[model samples]
Target: MNTFTETTNTASTWGLYEQMRPQEIEAIQEKTPIAYLPWGAIEYHGNHNPTGLDSIKAFNLCKDLAEKNGGLVFPVVNLAANLIKSYPGVNFPKHSIEFSENLIRLVCEEYLEQLVAQGFKIVVLLSGHAGEPHLTILKTVAEEFNNKYPDKRFWALAEFDILPNDLLVANHSAIGETSLQLFYAPETVDLETLPKDRLITLELDAVSGDDPRLATIALGEQIVTSFVKNGSIIIEELKQKYL
Candidate 1:
């Protein structure tokens, strides 16, 4: 595909005007004022994966979509919700995770409000972290935001929703997330440092749900391709319906 880099709000060349700083943005805004925002947390992924796995995944996805469509990626927001604390054997939360969910929801709500105030008519919330409460709160906030600000028309969409199960759940590293990173950001990975012991494998499965050692760049590319196609389709449909 042809990749063209346009100046975005986050880019040094463009200021707060964001997708509208350039003449193209003004023209497109009148036609399709769409923006994609990624939300993820800063917590442990596994011994093999980096702690910024969620943020990295989210940022890369936004970058891909933004490259195709005209939009800007907000800086990553790292707030742990479900994966609050860790134990020796388990990389996930060890205690009850209730308080953090509310905190995360409020923070997200504020950010969403700011985005709307800044003139983003169509916003998408793409999250990599599967923390149930954090995700749940995000959904609630999206609903409330749309209801309160009908003109803005904001929506929260999961990356997996735009991908097929074969792409989302068939590979290593929680199925698709690991593969995507492998394809897009290989330097973030270290296969030599990966644990190979049988005991370690079983222990990791008990906590993180999938085996990270099995992740590959090829699998990640498949997932990324599927996401780009489906995500663009959804964005186009929303644009036709709303914008």
Candidate 2:
């Protein structure tokens, strides 16, 4: 009876490891040996969305999935690789808080090692940060960890990778990401702050793709629903294979 509708209730306190009591965690562990680790970054997402948008989105999605499918939801890692060197309108001193690729890889490896040591057989790493370098590093770390720990399973993926191609169209603070923020973290987005006169360019702003002005909460909800449904299926499959 774990339907999509049942899982979309964001108010549910079933998935978050930080929110659950020790006994409750023990009970969940008895049922499933899978864990969800959400990784995000504190990078600029234009004027409308918060810097923590990536992490927030990933954390919420992981929570939704863990609620439907049995698993432990680890706290989101907010620091990620932000490859915004060439992008304009970037306030490096103020907003850009990033870790090196090697450091990130090491962190991921350690996290996996600890999770496996804690008795989790399968660890699903969902990165909210869409930077190619970040994703590549994560994938490499996951591969190396799996090689070292043959008994444990590690799966790393970016958030967009799980979505359909149509919904997959996203960019820095564009319609896709804006809509998602509107749906998941409404308070963090400020559409009013966006310039209304001229079209935002990569130099003027880090925004790309379709205008975010066209974004709507309805569209965001649809995307989230689809992502959760698809993600739940993937998690179930992983469980069957590894746990």
Candidate 3:
């Protein structure tokens, strides 16, 4: 029933760090000293969506933005500070590396330092995970980093904040996220996997928002378009001010 035109080749000229050549990297830095880092967490989204939903959505959005606006899309950091344990079906896998709030802060600080060192004057930190604590930690780190290095500008915020109030209805694995996944990475979602009968479980009732069954690819496209438009506006404003 979804009558949306999907681009066969979604790739773009966004110089993703790992895939970019030296000349391409130099070109972006020379043209616009702006960089973006999409942050997300590896956690449960529901039975329908993939566990890496947060990172996947964030990275894809950043890639699209960078391709249009001219910047470098750093590799997505899929590790988040903490997992919301209250939700059912959530898994906190043990990491060989330390995954703590302090570590997150340190990692962000060092990454920004390196970006500045590489001649990037402005850095955007966009997170797909909406955990209040996680967002707060990132905000605190960005503020501290800016204070220490006033020459470089850093802004950290959740991706949903870029959307208009009407299109900003977001939840953990509900319609918003589910629709995003359906649009951005359709292979990662299988609506048929969700339980048919509505049970009053934490995963279904408490964590998830309105019925994900109502999610549509059209809605996903609208959300993505809104994010790109608003994000581009913010990026242009920063460029005008910083560059």
Candidate 4:
């Protein structure tokens, strides 16, 4: 038996076993101890999106996933792996890829160790910020952790990976991520304040995508639906094959 729970009341659900009453915790412990970690970064998206976009995306997506798969959901990790970009006056030059990667690895290892100590064996590191270097570093660290532990597992996904490779393109605050955030946290988005021109790949280069002004709650719902549907398939496959 593992210590975990399946609940949709996000505001009331216990994020960690430590946060729950002893009885509740024991009940979950008798069930499943697996957990879902939402890894996100605090970085600039653009003039429109929130700096906590990555965290927000991860949190919401994890919530959806946790509801479907019974497990504890750790709070969003706001500071993820990223680099600093010095824009004259628009944004601060806060690149911290190396630093962030080290910190992310340390924090994740510490957290996973703590959970293991508490009798949990599974911890998933789902990264919402899809920076190539960030993802690379994250995967490397996660693999090393798994190799060292051997009895535990770490995993990640940004939802886009489920799509066919040729059908996808490198998009930052464009159709992919923006659509996800829009679908997950529409209230946080304010299209009325958006630039007349679309901002493309806010991370690497100054590129724009389709006018985000046209982004609607409906589109957001569709994205979430797709993610949940595909994520369910993936989870089931992994569980049957690995767990």
TM-score of each: 0.78, 0.89, 0.86, 0.76
Candidate 2 per-residue lDDT over residues 1-243, each given as its tens digit: 012354343432355788888899877787777789999888877778898888888888777777777688999998687556534465434576877878898888888888987888888898888786788889888988889888777889877787877886647788888888898878788898888999976656677777888898878888878888887788778777776
Over 4 Å off, model 1: 1-32, 84-99, 170-173, 199-207
Sort by TM-score, best first.
2, 3, 1, 4
Tens digits of lDDT, candidate 1, 25-49: 5554454466667776666555555
Model 2 spans > 4 angstroms off: 1-13, 85-93
- List candidate 4 segments past 4 Å from native: 1-19, 84-99, 164-170, 197-211, 241-243
Per-residue lDDT over 1-243 for candidate 3, one digit per residue giving the tens place of the 0 to 100 score: 122232312332447888888998897688777788999887766578787888888888887778767778898887676565532374433321225778788788788788878888888888888775677888888998889877778989887787776675657777888888888888788888777787524444334566777788878889888777787788878878888
Worst 10-residue stretch by lDDT in candidate 2?
1-10
* TM-score winner: 2
lDDT of each: 0.64, 0.78, 0.75, 0.61
Top candidate (lDDT) = 2
Better of 2 and 3 by lDDT: 2
Worst 10 residues of 3 by lDDT: 1-10
Stronger candidate by TM-score (2 vs 3) = 2
